[model samples]
Target: MAGRIPHPTLKGPSVVKEIVIGMALGLVAGGFWKMYNWNEQRNVRAFYDMLEKGETSVFAEEKDRGPD
Candidate 1:
């Protein structure tokens, strides 16, 4: 009896293409995450700076002032 043909391979350029696509997708996701969290990061940094500068009453004053 005749032997059956082998399955198609998926190495070389095909693998490289998949890797590139995956990396591009990862970069896009990371960019979106950074963009979404930009404001939160900025606020955290601002709070840290205020604490460093000894502005301990800023949050209390804001609470007393209520909503803008």
Candidate 2:
């Protein structure tokens, strides 16, 4: 099987396309990471606020259950 396999030549336009695609992917990933970090920070802040307010059980359910 010594047949010459034809491969598409990677040239200037293809290189530019690759760069643009890579940048787009990076931006999307960065946005997701930012959102995750923001959510984590928000949860931490809420926990601290609960502690500041003297919550005995930080993870306890609210005692306002209406019925069993």
Candidate 3:
């Protein structure tokens, strides 16, 4: 019986490709998470702003925005 060994990389550009992919994905994910957190903080601040405006109604904000 005979066995063959596999080459880890075909002497190719694996390292450069891996680094580029890692950096690209990191930037995309980081930017997305940053925007998501910013949006959430703005929303919470707006909620408290409305509450301070004496706009607190028995109904939901979205629903209460309509006429009584």
Q: TM-scores, in order shown? A: 0.44, 0.64, 0.62
Return the candidate ranking by lDDT, descending.
2, 3, 1
Residue 17 miss distance in model 2 (angstroms): 0.3
lDDT of candidate 1 over 1-68, digit per residue (tens): 99999998865668778999999999999999998799789989998898899976455553466768
What digit string (tens of lDDT, one per residue) describes model 2 on residues 1-68?
A: 69999998865557778999999999999999999999999999998888888874557676887878
Off by over 4 Å in 2: 1-13, 56-68
Q: Model 3 compared with the native: what TM-score?
A: 0.62
- Residue range 3-37, candidate 3, lDDT tens digits: 99886877766898999999999999999999999
The number of clashing residue pairs in each candidate reads: 0, 0, 0
Better of 1 and 2 by lDDT: 2
| Ranking 2 against 3 by lDDT, winner | 2
For all candidates in order, the CA lDDT equals: 0.85, 0.88, 0.87
Candidate 1 wrong stretches, greater than 4 Å: 1-13, 43-68
Show the colliding residue pairs in model 3.
none
Instruction: Report lDDT (Cα) of residue 65, candidate 3.
Output: 59
Name the weakest run of 10 consecutive residues (lDDT summed) in model 2. 56-65
